[model samples]
Target: MSEVLPQFRLLQPGTAEEAIAAKLASPSARVCAGGTDLMVAMRRGLVETDTLIDLAGIEEMTAIEVNADGLHIGAGVNLRRIAGSSLIAKDCPAVAQAALTVAGPTHREVATVGGNLCLDTRCLYYNQSDSWRKANDFCLKYRGDTCHVAPTGNRCRAAYSGDLAPALMVHRAEIEIAGPDGRRRVALQDFYREDGADHLALDPTEIVTGVHVPPSDIASAYAKLRIRSAIDFPLAGVAVACEITAASAHRFSIAVTGTNSRPVLFEAPDPLTGDDDPDVFFAGLNKLVQKSVSPQRTTTTAAHHRRLSVAALASRLARKLSAA
Candidate 1:
């Protein structure tokens, strides 16, 4: 095991404004929420920093509330809070379900929903130690210029591993960010990019304040495939949300994670019925899902297998919601 270095200084900010000021003053400083991911990266020498800004001490950023408009989950809200809340389970089952898949009890206790959404993309080759990577010339996601997952590719092929991001995207959630310039909001779907290196679109100086989940009568579900029942990133995950109306009209949003650079939200046709059979709506949706996700090869698992299973995952979840 690598020894913990003692050179860094810690700053505990009591408010969101203070945290923002502290971060801006030390641009290279690492922000610590629950420290679940940051601590692991620091211990493994994957992250190098001179200062740490602890956001956990900020009072306003830890609030979680449901109102007449929607749900507002503060950035510092922990995974355990999301998982154990009756309001979360009742109002946003998809988000709750995604939270349930995040690691184990200790991990959940120390991990935050915002941290999970902003997690660093992962790859087997890039996730290794400096010594291990140097021995293999490194990969595109690390030091080498070429992507080991796809040698001829021009971009890093690191896979996203978040469990909550997809669920949020499918729900059409909005993100609230604060910086020196003040606060601004954007669709959660627009907050990410399709490239591993610049996955998040937020400015370096911006700190996510909270996430707003809009009110909807839509039904939703989240499903994930992983090697274990706990404490593992999904090999492939899917989230589906749609509305069922009096006119029998159907409007849907689907997002996939753990298989691409960022979550992809695609629209499927209304009624979603097909000529083959009434049940063929799901069959067609399964096909649509497969066509929408273009998963590239990565160092974790077989890219093709993960990509192909996304549609099935979505189809299964959609069927379950339809029955409910």
Candidate 2:
């Protein structure tokens, strides 16, 4: 990592409209909510920007409101607030739990919801220092022609390791975006694509303003497997949301991260009619994730290891939540 930080002109916008105007004025400028990820990438030489549009001064982006409809969280709200929110904790347990597990305490204090959602795809080969990447001939994500992870393929294999996306996916969330054209809402899952090099479908002029999760009564939980319990990104993360009543598992929506270019949301299977065997139910889930999750050699850990862990974490969370 470079010891010195890169210098850039920063633009502070007081409102979302102003922020959008600033971005329009500077097409190459990046919209920054919290600098947790952006600053690091800037210092690492992964990102080169002449201007940064900071959203910290936008008051509406920091607001978090819960009502009868559900939770409406602004993009700039810190993860710490979401992790400790009573409303979010009760109605959307998985969302709160995922927020609590992001990096460490200090990181959560500044990392914003928007930043996490729009996090850049990561890979061991691509996230190294400038000199290190140069010596290795850089990867397809940056300035190279071939992807180091899969030389034969044209697609970048970097993983989308964000924690909150999968959790929010299980709750059926929608993202609100503001751009040069106007404002629009899209399902959270639709906001991402399969390509790691350019996973988000956001236009250059667009800015994610907030996330809206409709009211839900399902019991949900999140669990992740990482090299370290804190500070490290997940090797594989799973979020399970189940609709259960009278102590029997009926329906489930499972989502996985860190194993794919974008978080994969598995479609819920046939409703368990209270007589389905636990072993059979879980076995099917394992097959579902293994068949759909195509984990490449992105991390130091073996590809198969992440695949198995993704299955295990999903099963564990499903079992626990199904019994809730």
The TM-score leader among the candidates is 2
Which residue pairs clash within candidate 1? none
Q: How accurate is candidate 1 locally (lDDT)?
A: 0.81
Q: 29-142 in candidate 1: lDDT tens per residue?
A: 888788887777776667788899888887888899988989999988989999898888887788999998999999988798779888888877777766777778877765
Model 1 spans with C-alpha error above 4 angstroms: 1-6, 273-276
- Candidate 2's TM-score: 0.97
Give the per-residue lDDT of model 2 (tens digit) for 1-324.
Answer: 564687789999898899889888888898887799988888889988899999999888898998887889999999999999998989889999999999999999999999999999999998888989999988888998899899999999799999999999999999999998889989999999999999998998899999999987878999888998978898889898998646554688888899899999976666555688888988888788788788889999998998988887887788777666
The Cα error of candidate 1 at residue 15, in Å, is 1.3
How many backbone clashes are present in model 1?
A: 0
The ten-residue window of minimal lDDT in model 1 covers 270-279
Candidate 2 segments whose C-alpha is farther than 4 A from its true place: 1-3, 245-249
Give all TM-scores, in the order shown: 0.94, 0.97
Clashing pairs in 2: none
Q: Count the backbone clashes (under 3 Å) in each candidate.
A: 0, 0
